[model samples]
Target: MKKFIGLMVIGLTALMVLSGCGDQKEQETSSGTKETLTVMASGVKNGTQGVFLEQFKQMVEKEYPELTVETTLLPDDQYLTALKSKLSTGQAPDLFLVQPKKASANSVEELAKAGYLEDLSDLENWDKIKDQGKNDMSFEGKPYALSSSISVLGTWYNKDLFKQHKIDLPTNWQAFLAACETLKQAGVTPIVMGDKDSFMIQFGMYQVAANQVYPSNPQFDDQLYTGETKLTDDVWVKTVTMYNELYKKGYVTDKSLGLGQPQAQQSFVDQEAAMIFDGDFSLTAIENDNFDLGFMAMPANEEGETYLSAATGAGYAISKKSQHKETLKAVFNKMTDGQSEMFTNWLATATSFTTYAEGDDLNPVFEEIVPAFEAGRSFYWSNQAWPSGTETEMQAKFSEMIGAGKLKPIDVTEAMQKKFEELTK
Candidate 1:
C-alpha cells in the first residue's frame, strides 16, 4: 500500500507540471508576439513634437497592448543629420518627423524622392487632414507626412512692459522701429534673438518677406524656381534691407550671436527684452512664466493690417522600409483624430492654429492673428519654396554679415542667389 501511494504521488506531480506548461503556452498564444515601433523626432519633450509623440505612444500601446513604442527626440540641427545617417545605413526608424516639401533637409518631398518615405494615401484619416496640410506633405500627388498644426511667425512682446511704457503695439514698419527706439531709450532690450540658430533669422525675415514680396508678386516663388527671379531682386533686397534695420540699430540683444533658441526664449520669458521675433511654437515656453504676453504680425509695409507668415508645422512620416508600417498607421489614425486627447494636448502645448476640422479655442495672444488667417492675408514661409540647404546657406551668409559687420545685405542676397542657382542646376 505504501509503494502504491508513492507512485500515485509522482504521477500527480508530473500531471501538475504538464498542466502548468499547457497554461503558459495558452497565455503566450493569447498575448501574441511583441513588436517594437521606433520613432525619432525633433523638439524637446515638453514641446509640440514631443507631446505628440508621447500621446501617440500611450494611445498606441494601450490600443495594441502587444506593441512597444520607443522614441528619440533631438534638436532640429542634429535630428536632420541623424535621420539622414540612419536612412543611409538602412536603420531608419519606423516613424520619423519631417518638414513639408522645400522647408528643410528632412523635408517630405526630399525624402520621398529618395525613396525613404512611405505613401500614406490609403490612411483612413487622409481625407480629414486639412487641404493645406495635405498639399504641404504631398509629393507627386501622394501624401507622406502628417502635419501637427499650422503656425504663424510674428513678434511676441511683453504686454506689461508695453503697457507700463504706454506704448501701443506697432502696426507699421516705421512705427515698429519707433517702438524699438522707445524701448531702447527706456533701457530695455528691444528685441531678443538667437542668431546661433540661424533659422531664427527666418522667423523675423519671413514676416517681412510676406509683406514685402508676396503681397504684390504672389508668384515670386514660382518665378524664382523657373529662373525668372532671384533673391538679389529688388523685392528680396528690400526685404533683407528692411529686416537688417533691427540689427543695425542695435535693437537685437548683444548676446544674440552666442544665444541659442533656449537661452533666447529664457531671456524673453525673464523680461530681459521687450519683444522677441519667434513663431507660435515658442508660445508654450513663453506662457509658462505667466507673463502677460501679446503677439503681432511683423509690420512689413504698414497697410495697418496684419500680413502673417504662416505654414503647416513639421509632421511625422513612416519609413518606406519599415516593417511595422501597418501598426504605425493604426497608431497614427488614433493619435491624429481631432477628437482625441492626443491632439488636444498637442494643440495646447503647441498653441498653434490646428488644421483639424474641430480646432481648439485660441488663446488671446493668438487671437490677434486670427483675423489675418481668416482674411487669407497670410503667406507661407518662403523657405517652403527654397531648395534643400539653401536656408542654411542663407543663415550662414547672414550670420557672417551680422558678425563681421562689413558684409552688406546685398552680399548676403547675392550669395543666397548663387546657392539657389547652384541647387537648381
Candidate 2:
C-alpha cells in the first residue's frame, strides 16, 4: 500500500490499465464541440492525483484544441469483477485503466486480442517508454499499451525501530529467520502480513521464487508453457516448505490472515507489528504514523539474496473496439507526457516512488535501506512477469494450503507443478 486501505487507497485504477488494453483510433471529439473520451480508473478523483490529472486535461484541451475527455473512477475489492461486468453489458469505457494484476490483465488482454483495445502499435512516442515497464502488454511484437513508470517491491521496516529493538537487519535466510524469531520473543510480530488480497501472496511467492527464475531459467515458466518440466519437482517442494515452516512458527499475526490489507498496514503502523513484507506501497501503510521507516526486499535465503520485484501501475492502452482512435491516442499522449509527470507526482505524494523517473524526493523508507537495496541478490518477480492465467490456480491453492496447514516449502513448487499441467492445456 502505498494504497491506504488496500493498494486501493492509491486510487490509480484507470492509470494502471494503460498497458494491458490500449488502442489507437480515428478522432471523434470535434475540434472544440467534443466527442467524450470516457475513462475508467479506480479510486477517488479528489486527491492531489486528481488535481494533477485535471491540470493535464486542461492543458490537453488547450494544446490539442480538438478533444474533450471524461473519466470515471471505480473502486472495490472486486475490481476485475467490475471490469468483467462492464464487458458483458457492452459498455466498457472508451479507454479504461488496468493493472497486470490477474483479473485486470486477463480481461484487458482478451479484449485487446479480440479487437477490444485499439492497436496502438504505431504511436509516435512509443519509443519513449521503458521496455521493462511495457512487459505486460507488448504482445506478438506489437505495442498495445503506453506504460509510463515502474516501481520496485521490497520489504519496508523502521530502521530506527530495528535498532531500538536491538536486532540486526537480516542479510540471508538464516539471518532473516533469526531476526523474525527475535522479534517474536520480544512481543513483536515478526511480519505484518495479509493474504486477504490474493496479490499479497504473489509478493511472498516471488520473494522465494524469483531468484530461481531470474534472467530466464525456463526450468519453470517456460517449461510449463511447453509441457517440458513437471511442476512437482524438487524446486516446488523447497519453496512451499519454506512457507509452511514460516506459518507453523507463529511468526505472523493471527489477525493478519483475517484482516484485510488496510487494517494489516494500520496495525503495523501502530507498531503492533515490527516488520511488514511488502513493496514501495508501504509509503501509505501507516497513514497515521509519521514515524521514520526503512525498506528492503525479502531477506535472503541461504544465498542471502532476492530477485528485484517489478510490479504494475499506470499503463496506457488504446481500446481496439473504439470507433474513435485519433482522439484516444491524443488523450493518451497528453496523459502520458503532459499529465503523467504531475499525476505521478500526486501518486508519489500519496505513496512512494512509482514513476520511472524522478519525483519530488525519494520516499524516506527508500533512503534508509538504499545500501541493502543496491546490494545482495535481486530478480524480476515471477508472478507479475508470468504469461496470462499461468499462476491463478497456483495462487488460489497456495492460500488454501496456508489455511489448511497442509503446506510446506516444497509445496510452493509442487502447487505450481499441479497448476501448470492444468493451465498449459
Candidate 3:
C-alpha cells in the first residue's frame, strides 16, 4: 500500500512539471518573442521632444505587442559626447537625435559621412517630406534622417507692453530701430538677451543675417563651403554691425551678459521687457503668461524686403548598426504618414511648424509671420549650413563685443572667417 501511494505521488509531481512547461510554451507563443528598440536624444523630460518620445513608445508598443522601447535623454553637451562614444564603441541606440545638415556634432551629414547612419531613402513617407526638409536631412543625395518640423526664429514680444508704450510693430530695419528708441525712451527695456548662454546670440544675429546676407546672395553658404566666398566679406561685416547696434545703443537690457536665457525669458514673461528673440520652440515657456503675446520676424531688411530666419529642426536618425532596422522604419512610416493617430498627436505636440500638409493652422501669435513663408521670403538659419563650430566662434566673439566692447564688427567677422577656414580644412 505504501509503495502504491509513493508511486501516485511521483506521478502527480511529474504531471505538474509537464503542465507548467506546457503553460510556459503557450504563453511564449501567445505573446511572441519580446524585442526592445532603444532611442536616445538631448532634451528635458517634459520638453517637446521628450513628450514625442513618450508618445512614440506608447504607440509603437500598442502596434507591436511584443516590442518594448527604451529611451535615454541627456542634456545637449552630454548627449553629444555619449552619442559619439556609443557610435565609436558599436553600442549606439537604434534611433538617435541628429541636427539638420551639418549644424551640430551629431548632424545627419557628419554621421552619414562616417558611415554610421542607415539609409532611410526607401521609407514609406519619404515623398511626403517637404523638399527643404528632405534636403536638410540628406547627405550625398540620400535621406539619412527624418525631419518633421520647421523652426521659425523671430521676436516674441509682449503685446501689452507694445500697446502701453504706443509703439507699432516695425516692418523694416529703420522702423525697428526707431521703435527700440521709442521703447527705451519710455523707460521700457526694448529687448532682453541672455548673452551668458552664448547661443542666445544666434537668435538676434541670424535674423540680421537673413536680411543682410542671404537676400542678394542666397548661395553665400554654398560659396563659403567651396571657398568662393568668405565670412570677412562686406555682407557679414554689415550683418554683425547691424546686430551690434542694438547693444551699442543700450536698447537691450543692462548686464545682459550676466543673465542666462531662462532669466531673460522670464523678464519677458514678467512684462519687464518689451521683446525677446527666440524660436517657436520657446512657446511653452512664454505662452502661459498673463498678458497677450505676439511673434513676428525681425524685420532686419529695408522697407520693401522681408525675410525670416527659419530651418528644419532637429530630428531622428537610425544607426547603421541597429539590428531593429525594419521596426524603426515602420515606426517612422506610421508616425509621419500624415493620416495616423500618431501623426496627429505629433503635430499637436510639436512646438514648431509642421513640415507635413495636414497641420497648417498655426497659433495666432505666429500669424504675423505667415506672409514671409507665403512669399518665399524665408531663409534657413545661417548656422544650419555652416560647419558645426562656426556658430560657437561667432557667439564667443559677439559676446566679447557686447560685454567688453573690445571687439568690433569687423573683428568679429574676421575671427569667424579664421574659424571657418580652420574648421573646413
Candidate 4:
C-alpha cells in the first residue's frame, strides 16, 4: 500500500510538470503575437506605386516588429477590378489606392459613399496634406483619402538638342511651330509621338486645351455636361486643331501611330527626337540619363502665354472593415511625419510634387515649369469631371480620327459629345 501511494504521488507530480509546460508554451505563443496587413496598389510591379509599397513595407516591419505587411501591385486595369471586387465582397485590403473624385473605376467619392473607406478627416496627417488635395479626395466635405502627389502635364524637351540647333524655346503656338520646322530642317524629329496608345496624344492635346479652351470659358465643361453647349463650339475645334497641327505639319514621327510609349520616350532619350508630350511621371525613366532636360508648359495661344495641366494624383485610403486599423494608422503617421526616412525615400523617386508638405527640392527637370504651377497658371485636366469610360471612348475616337484623316476636328468633338450624352443618359 505504501508503494502504491508513492506511485500515485509521482504520477501527480508528473502531471503537474506536464501542465506547467503546456501553460508556458501558451504564454509564449500569446506574447509573441503578430498582425498582418495587406495593400492593393495600382501600377506595374516595378512601377512607382510598387516601389512605394516596398519601401513602406520595410519601414513598417522595422517600426512595428510584430506586424507584417504584404502588397499586391497590379497594373491599372487589374488593380481597379481587384479593388472593386474586394470592396464589394467585404474582403478589401487593409489599405488601398483611391483616385481623385470622378476618376474612373476607383473614385474615392464613390467608395466613401459605399461605406467601404474610412473617413480620414480626423487624421492628424491632414495638416500636412494640401488643401486642394483634401478637397479633391473628399466626399460630402469629409476627407476620405490621403493624396500622395500632384502631377502636371507639359512638354519635356532635350535642352542640349535645342541649344545645338539654336532653337529658342517658343512661348506662342506660331513660334512653337517655327521651332519644330527648324528642328525638322536640321534632320531631327521634332516630336516623338506614341499614338499607338491614344492616351499619349491626349497628353499634349489636353495641355493645349488647358490654354486654348479653358481660359476663354472656364465653365465650358459644365455647360457641355448640361447640354447647354456642344463640342462643335469654336473653342473646342481650335483646341483639336492646335493638337493636330503637330501631326499635320509633319513634326511628329513618321510611324507615330505604330510607336508605343516606351519607344517614343526612348527616341527622345536617344536624341532621335527633340521633344515629347508627357507627364512628370515620365521622369522616373528620364532621370537616369545624363542629358540636359527641360520641361515647359505647352505653348498653345497667340498671347505667348503657357498653361499647365495639373491635378491631384492617386492617394491612399484605409478600409472601413479592416481589422488592423491601428497598425495601418501608425504606418501612415510614420510615412507623413516629414522627418521620417520614408518621406525622404518617397521624395527621391517621385515624378511630381507631394501633396503632403513641401517635398525635397523639385526635380531639376521641372525647373522651367515650376513657376507656372506656383503662379496658378495651370488648369485641371478636363476629363477629371467626366464619368467613367467617357475619356476612353474619346481616346478611341481620336485614334480613329487620326487614321481616317477626313473627320473634321468638329466631327471628332461631336462624336465625343454624342458618346457623353449616351453614357450619361
- Highest TM-score, which number? 3
What RMSD does model 4 have?
A: 14.0
* Model 4 weakest lDDT span, ten residues long: 1-10
| Backbone clashes in model 3, listed as residue pairs | none
| Model 3, span 233-288: residue lDDT tens | 99999999999999999999878999987898898888888899988878878886
Candidate 2 error regions (>4 Å):
1-34, 43-70, 75-78, 85-90, 100-109, 212-219, 287-290, 334-361, 368-377, 385-392, 407-415
Over 4 Å off, model 4 = 1-35, 288-290, 346-349, 357-360
Candidate 2's residue-wise lDDT over 1-425, tens digit each? 21222232222333332332223223333343555555555544554334434554554445343446666554534444666677667776666655542233433355566665677766655554545445555665666665443455667676666887787877767777888888888877877677786566666666666544443353465465666655566555566566555667887776556777667777778878876767665454354545667777665456734455554444545565565566556545534453454344334433443333333256555664445334623444554434445566566777777787666545555666665556446
Worst 10 residues of 3 by lDDT: 1-10
Per-candidate TM vs. native? 0.87, 0.77, 0.89, 0.87
Residue 15, model 2: lDDT of 38
> Model 2 scores what on Cα lDDT?
0.55
Give, for candidate 2, the lowest lDDT window spanning 10 residues: 2-11
Residue-level lDDT of model 1, residues 142-239, one tens digit each, is 99887657778889998899888888978788888898998999999999998877778888988999999999889999899888888999988888
Better of 2 and 4 by lDDT: 4
